[model samples]
Target: MKINKEEKTPWICDKCNKELQLSEIKVVYLGGSFEVELMQCPECKMVLIDETLALGKMIEVEKGLEDK
Candidate 1:
């Protein structure tokens, strides 16, 4: 899924109070790793995984790996 930072409301980091920027982050799951653009805090390096993503692509990938 493509997350356009410009189209959505900006997310704030709870710890750093910094506005989250769209960043390329490394994601690891079921022994697989890949880069995905996500909302992140520059200061604390915190990544936000929204519910839709957690329940959507991530879940699908997890099931696919399990089936493999």
Candidate 2:
């Protein structure tokens, strides 16, 4: 998998007011779990999702899945 560097430069947490850390997270949707790399707040562990994933692959895969 490839990541766009320009889209994921750096980020800070609004609640903690601290720099975010790059980590792999488990995201579950519709009874399915996926491991994705995201920027998260070290203090709060709040995961961040970018527009590329939200509007791109995330939505694409969502439409292709069934409840079974």
Candidate 3:
């Protein structure tokens, strides 16, 4: 799944003080890995997983993987 920055509020990286950019990120779960677009810091490479995604698609994928 692709995650785009649709929110009006921009996310900033606290460590780098830089605005997060929408880019493809590699996510690993249960020994599975996939790439998806997400907000991340270009300099620090810090990825942001918002509450909505954590509770929604992330949870769904985790459950689906665990069931397998």
On lDDT, who's better, 1 or 2? Answer: 1
Model 1 weakest lDDT span, ten residues long = 27-36
* Residue runs of model 2 more than 4 Å from their true location after superposition: 1-9, 66-68
Q: For candidate 2, give the lDDT of residue 9.
A: 50
- Rank by TM-score (best first): 1, 2, 3
Candidate 3, backbone clash total: 0
Tens-digit lDDT track for model 1 on 1-68? 98877796679999999999999998887776767889999999999987877787788788889899
Ranking 1 against 3 by lDDT, winner: 1
- After best superposition, candidate 1 residue 23: deviation in angstroms? 0.4
Scored by lDDT, the top model is 1
In TM-score terms, which candidate is top?
Answer: 1
Model 1: lDDT equals: 0.86
Total backbone clashes of model 2? 0
lDDT tens digits by residue: candidate 2, 23-67: 999877655567889899999999899898678767756776853
